[model samples]
Target chain A: MNSITSNVFGPAKSINVARVLLCLEEVGAEYELVHMDLFQAKEQKSPEHLARNPFGLVPALQDGDLVLFEARAIAKYVLRKYKTEQADLLREGDPEEAAMVDVWTEVEAHQYHQALRLIMLECFLNPTLRGLPTNQAVVDEAVEKTKKVLEIYEARLSEHRYLAGDFFSFADLNHFASTFYIVDATPYGSLLDSYPRVKAWWEDLMSRPSFKKISANMTTK
Target chain B: MNSITSNVFGPAKSINVARVLLCLEEVGAEYELVHMDLFQAKEQKSPEHLARNPFGLVPALQDGDLVLFEARAIAKYVLRKYKTEQADLLREGDPEEAAMVDVWTEVEAHQYHQALRLIMLECFLNPTLRGLPTNQAVVDEAVEKTKKVLEIYEARLSEHRYLAGDFFSFADLNHFASTFYIVDATPYGSLLDSYPRVKAWWEDLMSRPSFKKISANMTTK
Candidate 1:
C-alpha cells in the first residue's frame, strides 16, 4: 500500500525545491520530480500552485489527500512518515538530542539561509536569473553576516561531527541545497576556506550520496 | 523534581522571548521570566549571555545541562518536556495533524514573521527604540507583503478555527506575541482590521490569559 516514490512539483535548481528532493533521496524514498519553469511560465504563481502554498512558493508535495509546502515542514513530514534506516535523522526519540537539532535548524533557517539568500539574490540570481546588475553593497552585507554565522558553526563543528552531536540530523541536511549553490555559482564559496571546520562539515554534506544524487538530477533536468 | 517553573532569559517585549513565555504559560510549565535590557546596558551581547547562546540572542532556556535558544525551538522543547493537558498542543501522536501544525509554523517563521519584522523595524522600532527616522518605503513594501500573507490567513481561518485546526496548537499560539505588538505599537495593526478572520484570530490570541499576563509583565518591568 506504500511507495516511497512520491510526486513532488517545483522548479529545478531552486534551493527550497532541492531541500524536499534531498530528503526524499536521504530516506531512500522513491519520488517523481516534476519541474515547473519559474521564469517563463510563471507557474508557481498560478492559481493551482497558489492553492498548494498561498505564499506562492514552489516544491509542493502531493501524496494522497495530503498537500504540503515549505521545504523544512515538508522535510519534517517526510521524516516523520517514512521511517527508513535514516529514521533517526531528527533524533526523534531523544528529547535532548532533538533539541540540538531544533536549535541548529532554527539557526540555519533564520540566520544562515537568510544570509545566503540575500547574497544569492544580489549576486547570481539578480544578475543572471533576472538580468539585474549585481549589488555589491548587499553582497557585502550578506557576506559579513554569513561569515559571523559560519564562525559559530566552525566552533560547534570543532567539537561535534554534525550540527547535532556526532550524528547527522535534518539540520545538516538542510544546509545542502543553498550552500551547494554558494559553493558552485558564487564567490562567497571562498569564505568557507577561512573556516576550516565549517569547510570540512560542508564538504562532508556535499559528498553525501543523497545530496550528490539530488544535485545531479537538478542539472540534468 | 519536575518544576514547571523554568528559567528563561532574554530581552523584554521581544517577539521571540514572548513566544517562549507564552508556551510556558500554555503548557502550564512553571517558568521564571528574566528580563535583560537590550538597550542602555546592552546585556544580550554580554559574554555570559553569549555562552548560553553562541549567537547571543534569546530567550535561552537552562534546565540541567540543556542550553537552548531560538524561541520556536525553545517553545518546542518546552512543549516536549513538560506534559500537561496541553501535551497535545503539537499534535504529537497524529502525523497528519502535526503536518498542518508544522506547515503553518513554517509560515509563521519564514513568511509571516519576516514581513511583519520589516514593518515593525521600519515603522516603530527604529523610530522609538533606536531614535532613527522611520523609512516609509521599507514600511510600504513590508505592508504590501503582509497584506498578501494576511489574505492567505483570512482564507485559511475562514475554514478552520486556528492555523493548524480547530484545536489551539503552537501554530496558533506562535502568532500571539508579534501580532500583539503589531496591534499595540505599529500602524500595521490597522491592516488587520481589514481581514476580519485574521483580526479575529489575533483577538483570540491576545485574549489568552498567558498572553495577557506576559504582555502585562513586559510593561511593568
Candidate 2:
C-alpha cells in the first residue's frame, strides 16, 4: 500500500465521479484523475477499463492493490483510509449519529438523485448530449417527483442545519453534485428558491471550497 | 441507548420492510413490527407517521429515542447495535474487504434493485395490487436491464462465493427481498436459472434460516 495517491478513473463531467473527487478534495488526499469518457469515446467498455470495473462505469478507483467501483464506495474508502481533519464524515465514534448520516445519504441517492437524474436526462442530457428534443412530459413528471422529495428536505433542513444534523456529513455532500446541475444548468433553478431552507442548504454546500474546485468547469454551458 | 428492542413500522409485504426484518433475524435481534400499510391504509401519510419519516414512507424504525427511516438504514442500525455472532456483516475487521462489500451493496440496490422493481411493478404489483393489466413493454425493458446486471453478478459469483468475496456479507443480503419477488411471483423465474452461478448464489441466500422465517408467508399466491 505504498502508493497512497489514489487513481480515480472517470470523466470529469460525471456527477458520481465529481462526488469522489469532492470527497478526496475534502480530505485533502492526493489523487490523480484518469478521465475515461464513457459516452463519446466508448472507452468504459474497453477491456482494460472493464478489468477495473466489471460494470464498465466511469468511476473505478485504484488505491494500491484495492481497485473499487461505485463512487460512493470509493468515497467511503477514502474517509476510512485517510485520517484527514475532515475525514470524520460518518461520526466515527457514535453509532446512532453515524446511522443517521447513512440514513439520509441513502435517501439522497435513492430518492433525490434518481428524480434529479431523470430531470437532467430530459432537460439537459437528451437535448444537449444526444441532440434530441426535451420531452416536456418527462420533465413535468420528474419535476413533480423532485418537488415531493424537496419538500421533505425542506422540513429536515428547516430544523437541522444539514441533512444528518447540525454537522455536515457525506449525507450532505452527496446532494451537491446532482442538485448543483439542477441549480446551475437546468430550467428549475427557481424551485430551490421555493424552499428557503433547502436553498440555504444548497448555498452552504456550494460555498465549500472542495466542491467549488471540483465543479469549477462542470456547468453544461 | 438502554432499550435494545426496536419497533419497525412498515407493511408485511414490502420488500424494503422484509429486508429490515431479515437483517434483524440474521442478528437474532428483538424487534416489534408495527404494520403501517402505505398504499391501502395510507397510514404513511398520517401526521404521526410523517413525524417519523417526513418522506411519508413505510419502514420507519423507532429504537429508544432514535427514529430512523429508509429500510437499509434500519438494517444497518440493527447490525451495528446488535453484536450477535452474525452481526459482523460488513467485514468489520478489514477496510479493503468492507469497501468491497459496500461497492456491491450499492450495485445490487441501485442497478439490480431498480430494474427488478420496475419489472415487479409491471408484472406483479400493478396487476395484483392495483388490479391493472400487466404492461409487457415495461417488463421487457426491465428484464433486459436485469439480465445485464445479473451478468455482472454471475461473473463476480463465479470467482467468489458471495458478492463481496468468498464469505457472505450484507452485499449479498441486499438482493434477497426484491429478487425473491421476481423469482417467486413474476413470469421471469426462469431468467435467474439462465446464469448457473447467479442461480446458486440466490439459492444460498434463500436457504438462510433468517430469510426463510421472514418470507414464510410472503408470496403472491
Candidate 3:
C-alpha cells in the first residue's frame, strides 16, 4: 500500500480538482490531498507547484517518481494503476465500449466544458473572485451555447441511460465536476430543468456515492 | 477484413478530418474515406450526418456496427483496433509513459488547439468560407495566446525530443494536423521561426512517413 501512496495537489473547491477526487473516490483509492490556496495565496503559481505541472494548473498527481498533470489524465492514471473489480471507471480491457467512452469524454472536454466554463467564470467565479457583479450578457450567451450542447445530450440520454450507452464510465465522470458547479454552485442550475433527459442523467450521476463524497468535501469559498 | 471495414466522414480539407487521417496512416490501417461537403453544400448538417454525430461535427467514423466521433476518440480507436508492432502510437502497455502521453495530449486539446483554431478561423478559414476579410484583432489575440503555449512547448522540446518526453506517441500525433494548418495554411506560420526548438520538433514530426502520406492526400479547398 505504501508503494501506491499518491499525492494530489489543488484546492478542493477547484472544478478540476473535484474531477480527479471523484475518480479517486470511484476507484476507492487512497491518496494524500495537498490543498493549494489557489485564490488567497495563489500557491498554484509557485515554483514548487509549477515544477509538478509546467502550466501551473491544479489537480496534479504524484504517484511515486511519476508526476502527472491534467485532471483527466491523472484520472486515467488512477484508474489504470489502481485495479478494482467493482470500479468500472475506465471499463478497462473493453476496446469498443472504451472507445465509445472516449468519444463522449472528448465531447465533454471539447464542446460541453468550454461553453459551461464560460458561464461559471462569468456568472459564479467572477463575482466571488473580483468582488464584482455577474455579467448577465456573457452568462446568457454561454447559457444559450450550453443549451445547444445539452440538447444533443438530451437526445442521446433519451435513448441510452448514460453518455456512453447505459454504462457509467469516465464519459459521465468527466462532466460530473463542472456540471456540479453549473447546477449547484452557480445561478444557472435551473437551466438543466428544461432538458428532461439531461436533468435525469445529471440526477443519476449525482446520486453516485463517489460523487456524493467528493461533493461533500468541496470547500465553498 | 471486410467485416472490419471502417469509413471516415468529413471534408478532406478539414483540420479535424486530417487528425483522424493522420492516425490511420500512422497505424498503417486501411479505412474508407467518406467526404462530407462542409462548405458549398453544407452536407454535415444533414440528418444522415447528424445520426453519425449528433453535434453535426465532421470526422465521424463508422466501423461496421460501431460508429464513433470526436477526432481524438476516432484516433484512439484506430490506434487500438489496428495496432502495429513497429509503432506504439498510444504507448499502450506502458502506464507511466502512457500517462505522460495523455498529459501532453490533454494540453494540446485543452490549451493549444483552442487558441490556434481561433487564428485558423480568423486568418485562414474565415476568408475562404465566408468571403470575409481577415480579422487582424482576433488573429493577433490568438497568436499571442499561441505564442505563450509554444513557449512552454519550446521549453519542453528543449529537454525532450517530443511533447510526451522523447518518444513520438499520440500526444505528438494529436497536434500534427492542427499545427500543420497553423504553420502552413495560416500567415502565423513564421511564428515558429522564433521558437527554434518548436520549429525543429515540427520539422522532425513532419518528416514522419505517416504524416507525409496524409499531407499528400489532403484536398486544399
Candidate 4:
C-alpha cells in the first residue's frame, strides 16, 4: 500500500482534486488516488474520512499518522517532504520570490476563486440543483470581474514566463486549474484568446509532463 | 526611522489593521502607523499608498526596501523575522504540529475571511455607503454559516487551548481580528457566549501580553 492516499470525489471533474494529483506527479511520489462516491455522500462523511478532514471535503491526503486537507497545503507538504530540485517549481529560495508566490496563491484563493465559483454556480449548480433564476446581470458582473483578473495575469505573463516569475511553480498550477474551469464554463472564456501572453502561458502549462500524466489518467464520471 | 511603516485608512476600527497591529505588538517591533484620511479619500488612493498596495487597501506594511501589502502575509512575516522562539509559537519543530498550524492558518484565510467579509459588507458597507437596504436575510445567512464554522472551532477548543492546539500561536491572533468584529456587529455575538470552551479560549487569547499591547494603542478613527 502507498504511504500517501488522496481522498477525492466528483470524478476527475473537480479542479481542486486535480491540484493535489498533479502535485504528486510533479514530485514523482507514489500515491493512491481514492475516488469517493459523492452521490452516496458515503466516503466524504464516513467516520474515517471525517477524522482526516472535518469539513468532509475531497482532496484530503493522509501520510502514515499525519492527515492533511486543503489542496494547496497538501501540495506544499509534498514538495517539502520530497525536497526535489523542483522546489523552485513550487516555491523559490529567495524570500521575495516566495512572497510573490504567496501573493499569486492568495490571488487564486480570493479573486480567481470568487469569480470562477460564481460562474460555476450560475452555470451548473444553480441551473441543476438550486432552482434559482439565472441572473444575466450577475453573470455579466462575474465575467467582467474575471476579465479584470485575467488582465492582471496577462500583464504579469507578458513580463514573466510563469505566475511567480521565471519558475513554473504550483502557483501556475493553481491559476491553471481555475482558468481552465473559467474557459470551460464562462462566456468570458474567449477573453483568454485575446490575451496572447496568457494563452501561451496556459499552453505551456498544459504541456508539462506531470500535468499530462495525471490529467490523462483522470477518470471523469 | 522605525523598520516598519504602515498606512492606515478605512477607520482604525478596521479588523484587518487590528490584526497587523496585534502581530506587531507580539513581535514588539517598532513601527510608525500613519493614519490615512479615508474620509477625504486621501490615503488609500494616494499615489504613494497605491504603490504600497495596488488594491488601495489600508494596513499596508513597508519594511525597508521590501514592501508587503496583505495584512495576513505581513503579520506572518513580522513573526518570522522578529521572534527567536518561532518553533514554539508557530509549531515549527514537528511536521505534524507545523502542518496543523498551516492548516488552521489556511482555514483562517479561506473560511473565516469569507464569512467575516460578507457580514461586514452586509452589515456596514452596503447600508452606509451604497444606500442599499440592509439585507437582514444576507446577514442572517452569513451568521448561520459563521455559526457552523465556530462550531468547528468550539469542538477544537474543547480539546486544545488555541486554534492550532496547545500553543498560543498567530492562528489565534489571525482569528482575533475578524472574530472581534463579528462579536461587535452580529447577533451571532451571543453565540460565542454559549460555547464556554470558545469563550475560555478567547479570554486566554485576549489576556496575552501582545493582545493587551495592541488593543491599548489602537487609534479609532
- Candidate number achieving the greatest DockQ relative to the actual structure: 3
Tens digit of lDDT per residue, candidate 2, span B1-221?
Answer: 34567899988789889988888888887899998767777999999998998878879899888999998888888877775565678775588898998998888877888888988888888887899998888889998998998898889899999989988888988988788898888889889889999999888898999878887858776
Residue-level error in angstroms, candidate 3, position B216: 2.4
lDDT of 3: 0.85
Q: With candidate 2 superimposed using the best TM-score fit, by how many Å does residue A146's alpha carbon deviate from the native? A: 2.8
Off by over 4 Å in 1: A219-221, B219-221
lDDT of 1 at A219: 51
Which is superior by TM-score, 2 or 4?
Answer: 2
Q: How many collisions per candidate?
A: 9, 0, 0, 1
- Provide the lowest-lDDT 10-residue window in model 4 chain A: A1-10
Question: Scoring each candidate complex against the real one, what DockQ results?
Answer: 0.81, 0.83, 0.84, 0.46
Ranking by DockQ: 3, 2, 1, 4
DockQ of 1: 0.81
Candidate 1 CAPRI assessment class: high
| Candidate 4 local Cα displacement, residue A21, angstroms | 1.7
lDDT of 1 by residue, B1-221 (tens): 36445789986588889888888888777777788887888788999999998887878998767788888889998888775665567886788888899999989887888889887788778888889998899889988999988999999999998999898898888877667767777777899989999888887877888878888865521
**Ranked candidates (TM-score, high to low):** 2, 1, 3, 4
TM-score of chain A of each: 0.94, 0.96, 0.94, 0.86
Per-residue lDDT, model 4, residue A84, is 71
Candidate 4 per-residue lDDT, tens place, A1-221, comes to: 34555443324556777887777777777777777776555677888777777777777887877778877777777766665764445453455666667666766776767877777678655765568877777888887887777776787798899877888876788865666655655455676797899899888987888766765654222
Candidate ordering by lDDT (highest first): 2, 3, 1, 4
Q: Of the native A-B interface contacts, what share survives in model 4?
A: 0.24
